[model samples]
Target: MKNIPKVTALCLSIVFISLSSISNAQQRYTDYDPIADFYNRFWSVPLERLAIGKLEKIMLPNLKPKAEILDLMCGTGHIAATLHKKGFRMTGLDGSAKMLEFAKKKIPNMKTILADARYFTTSKKFDAVICMSDGLNHIMKEEGLTKAFTQVYKALKSGGQFVFDMNWEERYIKGWNLRGLRVEYDNSEGIISSSYNKNTRIGSIKFWLYYPIDKAKNTWKRKAWELTQYCYTPQQIKKALQTAGFQTIKAYEANQDLGDARNAGRAYYVCKK
Candidate 1:
């Protein structure tokens, strides 16, 4: 790593130790399998809109109609599908097999990959790479975050840009520190509860999905998953990007540069490699 600023160096060191703690916490948890099946029905439309808006802001200055782009941690390919409609060549990657399955079904011509963002790589480079909707936060540790950053840097062609967002503490205090959040579909209902710990800067969401299997008999399918996210200060994020070799970096309020992202409760970063 190049010589980082003192404050940034300190932040990087903090992330080094935090990774172990985060890993321990992770071992106690299990992945949510059904969330992938539920993703499109619940979150795809709004999240895809915000992501497309942000990408337009970054790409409008000089965009190639068929620019090769990678969507990291792409859940259900909502954003990629939107970009594809605009004539961009899009690839969607996510760790969830079910999510990618749905994405492939939805976009038969689009390419999808099943991989973890922290260690994902490819010989094929891209014009731009995007990790949005608090996808970076899902890494749960600074070191893994840095690795993801490095991987993105290496995967981009010269002058390629990386765009992503992370949740702010303010977002956690207001959004995650809540309970009894409920979503109901015609045959499926889900109860979501969220909590955040200031000391650990860890936010967790527990989702209980109930789906009717038999209408008259009232038989239901119950599935659950626990998700965790870590909060990082702007300094930490900048430092990590810098360490990953991003030369030009810009930070924007979720909606300042992209209207659709206003009050999105996350900070967006655009970095050039």
Candidate 2:
């Protein structure tokens, strides 16, 4: 009886430590639940346009008309909607339920899957798979990146293409270093701040959005969240793609290929399985 208390305490301590470690691991990735509305409303438009333009130039020409396309990390379904209009069958897959809610609302007839990019499987293989707006960067480890590529590979048809963009180190150094970090709207204001750790090759961006709940009472509400991205070298990415059975891989510097000044530190990869 005397020793039972010590054993219970030890088990409790182990459980606590395990839970804490799980939480810490989860914190390494961003949860889009809180910011899904803000992102859908404020941030996705221009980026969607840019991505569409690039896709048209780079990936669309290689596809058959009405090709089956999978939009991986397809937040809000904007790209899927646009491509749907262009005559392709679109299916969106995203990790965030809130983001998928918006996506489903946007395209009532479209199919959206809520699953992690690293492990999602589909009975339907796609003609092309796209992960846009630095989506792959959110996979914070090389193992996760490789797994994501493998899953994408498995989801694609034979000779299918995978197209995605990633942020290079220069993007974090120049863009995320507190540049253009503040914005205001009629009813809300937002501030974004970020940091990049060279040693870990990780970058984190924190967002704070404030909106008025009652103008007469001067009452306001604020929502805050942080997101992290990992920076992988081109060599690392290419190797992972090859390991995932992508034989024909071509990389293009976004600004050079698209002639867009905004894409200075971004690169796009087109891989064929």
Candidate 3:
């Protein structure tokens, strides 16, 4: 073959390096999945305070939940605990053992099962299935999206609905160009933020952990942790749901009624099987 131009070769080399680093960055580590940490601290912590109100006003109000509610991808059982307190029968399902451990500690009375979101079952079916907080965007492939919807369809009662949301790529593109930010929860741990890489379309948040070497000493310590996930568009999500046997489909923007708005960047789907 002919020799490649230097400029073109350099660009190709940069892409290869980026891809290789992404692979190693996501490589699973010692009983610690970065996603689990994110679930445990970042979103879960805030949801613990906000999910109850959102569910009551946004999700559960429109319809009644006749039976139990399945919180698929329920990190730390944050929503489950609220439902449990409200006297609504609720159960949590998640694939991350690390997260489930923290969830158990938080909601000792609530029941939790370990299973992948794409294929999970329980002894009893649910009247409503809610997988919120951009859990829909985690389906890195078209097939995974269909499988998840199909499985949720089988698990829900005929009149029940599968509700979930995803952030738009526009949000990622608009946000990622900015440099990383720092938000320290304490000396030990804090959040460092960065928006999407336009070329790669990957957004990330790095968590830093600093420890005290000694109470009497002047110095402390530091550790680095990172989490990343792919982003998806509304069109891709809608097509996947339609193909997955959902008969009635409603898509909405963030903080809007569960009605169709294809152009909306942040999307929520209320799918009836």
Candidate 4:
């Protein structure tokens, strides 16, 4: 009896440790699978417009016609499809398979890769690399940000440009944290909640969505997910880019540079390798 009790305790401890490890792993990466459809349908358009406008001004002019471009962390493929229409060779890379499914559907001939920004490798170099819509913010650690920048640097040819956008404290506070919580669509409804920790410089958004499952029976299903982002100052981002071997860097406030009020608190960067 005494031995049985000790054995049970040890087994329970082992199970607890295993579960903790799994949870930590999950927390390290945000899984977009659950909300990929929603993002594709609703969230991709405005973000795509912002990225395309900035790219036209800062990236396209510097590249030759039909130049190769890598859309890093490309979600839903909206921007890639737009660029492809403009005669650019577009390659989309994203960590979420579900997100890439939409992209592939949009551009059947486009090359899409499912890989993490921090550790992706490419067989061919690109003339320009873009990580837009605050993609780099998803890399929650400074070391990871540096790793992603290094990967991007390696993926680009000499003299190639790397352009990206990021949100600072202003965006999180005024945009996400203070925005209305409820969103409604024809078939589904969502509630959004967000928080930012100044000390950790991390922001998180939790989404809860409800939709019809069995319309005849008046049944509904609910899905929930949370996403976390880290806010790095321009100085910190510039340091990371420099460490990754980018020499010339220019930063632009999107609201001032792009002339869009919706881009308030967003900053764009253009770097040359």
Candidate 5:
């Protein structure tokens, strides 16, 4: 009876610690479905079109006509669509089913795979594999990024090309420190809040989306989700590519030839096996 208070306090402390662990885990994990479902509605507009168009023009000269291509992390199929129109056989792969649904609607008869880039595999190898638009930044772990690179290497045919782009650490440190960005479309709108942790080098963005109940009504539906991206330096990217068995690698800054200098947050990489 004399020791009852001490035992009770220890048990309470354990419970409190467990609860804190669970909360932290929840904060670290994010579900991508909401962002996927509303992806095109909010993103890949005129600017996205222009970027994809420019990228296609720059890469087209390097690829054989009608080459089989795999667009890894093929969000909303923007790049795949562009390449397909230019006569490349494209298969889009992404972890999000909802995003694939939108992509299918945009490009009918397109093949898509629902799998994480970290562990994705395919029996059908590709002539060229692309993971663009800073898709590698979403891995959140260096090991996971390496896994994705290795998987992509395995999925490419001999002497095949891998082209992708990544946002430099500079972008996260300076650009992603945003607060309450308001974005609007025809009948939908949203506010985006973003922050970057200097120590972790992880950038997080929270989206709050509003949809009109009716065109004339004041009522709206709301949805929210959080996304996180890890930052990598140019040297880190090159090392990953080399470790994944790429024979040669060339990285081009956005302003060099491919994209507009105004959008110089990212650099493009071309590697060959």
Candidate 6:
């Protein structure tokens, strides 16, 4: 029949579309099992206690005093609080309301908005933009990452810089092996959560959680979920920034300029719009 080939083509197209939709739907739901304050904090163990300090040392030396700064994906306003105290006009943005709840208390004077980095804009452009704590990894796809940098460019004044970080597959393989991956953090409040994720190189680490909401309660356990991403190399990051209209792109190792094992084993990006 004349329609036989057309029918077969339609069936194959439907199947392919269904499979692609399934994969995207899976990624849409992948996120951390929420605890009181832990998941959004992203197990601060990998970063030093002074993450804000290390990051500030990177930018503050070059930043003009009293400049307007935008903190993209500013979880809990950690660094923003410090920068605000230093007399910088700080505005923090993140998609997490749970984290923003904590941030409001920490930096009462700083402004915070709940918005994803890729789609947010402000009435005022900032002199510089920074996203910390591996915030860039959460973007997941190359298209979204490009959109994110483009948004940063739109939000920044000319000659402004956009800085962000993420895990490198190269470094993750070298150090993020499952054999020794465990994290425990808590304050003497009404909560405690300790958890670990087995290693997966393809995209993200599969993570689990055990959180106690109350000290009086015996157990608080939530099952695990996968956080997926297309990991980018240093070259890929620079290329994406360039595509997004960031003219001056640079990469840095975290602690030492040569490549700090903890922070810079992979790298962070500093781009000028």
Reference-based TM-score of each model: 0.82, 0.84, 0.73, 0.84, 0.79, 0.72
Native-referenced Cα lDDT, model 2:
0.80
For model 4, state the Cα shift of residue 141 in Å: 0.2
Rank order by TM-score, top first? 4, 2, 1, 5, 3, 6
Candidate 2's residue-wise lDDT over 1-273, tens digit each?
011111111111111111001123333222676677878988789879989999988999999999999999998888989999999999999877889999898789999887878878899999999999998898877888898999999999999999999998878777777733776644667677888888988888777656666656655666666688888998999989988889899988867777877778899899998
Encode model 6's per-residue lDDT on 52-152: one tens digit a residue. Answer: 65566567778888999998877766677777888889988876666677678887877888776777778889999988777677675677788888889
- The sequence of per-residue lDDT tens digits that candidate 1 reaches over residues 246-266 is 869988776555553435567
Model 1, residue pairs in steric clash: none
TM-score of 4: 0.84
RMSD of 1: 12.0
Stretches of candidate 6 off by over 4 Å are: 1-33, 40-50, 180-201, 210-222, 255-259
The local lDDT score (0 to 100) that residue 210 gets in candidate 2 is 60
Q: Compared with the true structure, what per-residue lDDT tens digits does model 4 show for residues 1-273? A: 011111111111111111001123323233776678879877899889878888888888889999999999899999999999999999999877899999999999999887778878998999999999998898877888999999999999999999999998788777777343777755766677888888888888777666666656656666566777888998899999999999899988877777767768899899998
Q: Write the per-residue lDDT of candidate 3 for residues 1-273, one digit (tens) a residue.
A: 222112211111111111112123333111233346555666676755544544665567766544578888776777777777676677887766787777788778778887776666666777788887666555556677777787788888877878776777865665444343444443343335555665665666455544445535434455565455467666677777777778788776653453324323556667776
lDDT of 1: 0.74
In order of listing, the candidates' clash counts read 0, 0, 3, 0, 0, 1
Score candidate 6 by lDDT: 0.62
